[model samples]
Target: MGIDGGIGRLPLAVADAVRTGGGEIRTGAPVRELRRTADGWTVVTDGEVLRADAVVVAAPAPAAARLLAADSPAASAELATVDYASMALITMAFRRDDVASLADGSGFLVPPVDGRTIKAATFSSRKWGWLRDAAPDLFVLRTSIGRFEDEEHLKRDDADLVGMSLADLGAATGLDARPVATRVSRWDGGLPQYPVGHLERVARIRAEVAKLPGLRVCGAVYDGVGIPACIGSARTAADELLTATLAAGAVGGERE
Candidate 1:
């Protein structure tokens, strides 16, 4: 698939499309609760209460669990058991001339056994054509730190992390280059960890949620963690909700 500008641009485009389609988009408005009502469903957020025929709790497992605790206690409990991993990305940009020997490929992965702070590094300039064209004189690379239960490394200051990343990069690629610009992005509990019994747990959660009408849950907690997987899960949830709503309407019309 073609990446437009950067990975972040895709979400912005999606949001723009939704707006263009006359759909309301709210950012940073945390939903406080989901209440089932006689007419439909009530979504209580920090600012307002939105009434909808169906509600999809597309938050991370822990947040979703909190919202569903009152409606589907069983599902909430199961979702609460889902584990996650935290990681940080250190993006460094160096003057092309400062680096003696840049790697030929799109960076490399440092195995856990290698005893390095960075788990993986990506050569953003080489991997993405947009970035290369945007800054031809700069070499952009990003290094990831932290893994499951490996939170200690993230405590370091941004400068320290940058140093660590550069040291590791130098050792791996023999490029003792000084970065011209740096950025540190930390994602706490970003990636969900799918353990041995994760699928079973998800099945149980879904089954329990299915019992609650007008309520559905989807996100990194239930399906694959990648963007494509999350999108697929969302589509499935939306389709299920639409189908159920139509079936209920048909039954009500027949009774009328």
Candidate 2:
């Protein structure tokens, strides 16, 4: 199969497929605390407290820092250093007639050289199959803003963000349509930047966390930020947890 056919809208589509396979999703419940116990570990949530052989904290670096602060101060201290950028994505849907010179394909990535208020625009519908089928008469333009370099732009209001996106879109695709629907998503601390010596820092953090039995961490801040990388890290963390549990059991058996 061609690349696009094989990987098109894979994440969302796969999630939907899993739902068809009887997967359940939970919302509104947030974990409160995690404490290590003699037997294993305890997960404290708003409604319940549960026990598990191990834990893998997959939250962002700052949140992870707060979570690990009391128990794993060392790990928390290290995680606090992992920084993220604030960003906003504005998704605007426009009628084709209102937009001119826009192409139906992957979106354009803006290099810093563009020197524009908005970052990049993704032609969402054309790039993915499921989205394409939803609104045949409409075009979805996803524009990004705010980066480490452009920190000031993040303070802009919704009107400013929309204006910047529209300006860039107009310049790029000659699209001057007032969007039928506009959605803005603001990520407080966006994707983590793997700066120089990031690998070394992560290695040290992993080594420290390893010393804490029944404790593990897996997230975009740890291995990678991409979906595949996050999934891979979780899988690896699960395997590690299983190995540790088996080894502990063996020691207990010998003691008995």
Candidate 3:
């Protein structure tokens, strides 16, 4: 369901796999443009214009829309209409004795109707055995604030956000101890929202993308937003492009 060290490790591991499989993973090069070439796709980045047999654009909807604007305006238009939500995650570390008798569940989700500052709280130390074992003397937990449209709480400063979470935690679990350390991670326009006719919109985007050979797009906007769903979307796009490339004799493999 998740990574032990953290969700961040998943990308690192994927990078390792790419390198192990003789793939070159480039970073720090902001992509300037992506266009379909007669031969394949031309990817112009801050560094250079790289040619590829097939290209997959795995990015947020806005960025993806920009990249596809030149080659597939139809897809770009669809992507531009995709809505998003933002949130901030507050991770706090407390002494083990402080929350030794914390609740048993991994976390609880608060409904928007409740009007709580923190929409959810995850008891990380109790939920993940690896995390607890790694930091035996500390109790770590994460709280999330913000949702689809109601994100007024996220406008506050980090200290203010941390204070709000602490206040809510105290009232709910009687946790009044000060945390030893805290970190705030904000995801602006991160979660893609699926509204009415989302599937039809995605279908149109995919159809337009298919019109341009060697160009494919994937991410939270096209499919489900969970890590597993995103990963699956990437895989599906990669597979589809590879099949197209091989069928057209662009790659070495010959498809039957």
Q: TM-scores, in order shown? A: 0.94, 0.83, 0.95
Per-residue lDDT of 1-256 in model 1, one digit per residue for the tens?
A: 5585888888899999999998778899999988777756778887787778888889998899899888789999998888899999999999977764786899899888899989999998889889989999998999999999877989888999999998898888898878989999999999999999998998899899888776678877878998988998888888998899898883321100
Least lDDT summed over 10 consecutive residues: which range in candidate 3? 247-256
Per-residue lDDT over 160-254 for candidate 3, one digit per residue giving the tens place of the 0 to 100 score? 99999999998888889899999999999989999999999999999999888787888889789988888889999999988887788776321
Q: Which order, best to worst by lDDT?
A: 3, 1, 2
lDDT of candidates 1 onward, in order: 0.86, 0.79, 0.88
Clashes of each: 0, 0, 0
In Å, residue 97's CA in model 2 sits off its true spot by: 2.5
Model 1 CA deviation exceeding 4 Å by range: 250-256
Which ten-residue region of model 2 has the weakest summed lDDT?
247-256
Pairs that clash in candidate 2: none
| Alpha-carbon shift of residue 228 in model 2 (angstroms) | 0.3
Q: What's model 3's TM-score?
A: 0.95
Candidate 2 vs candidate 3: the TM-score winner is: 3
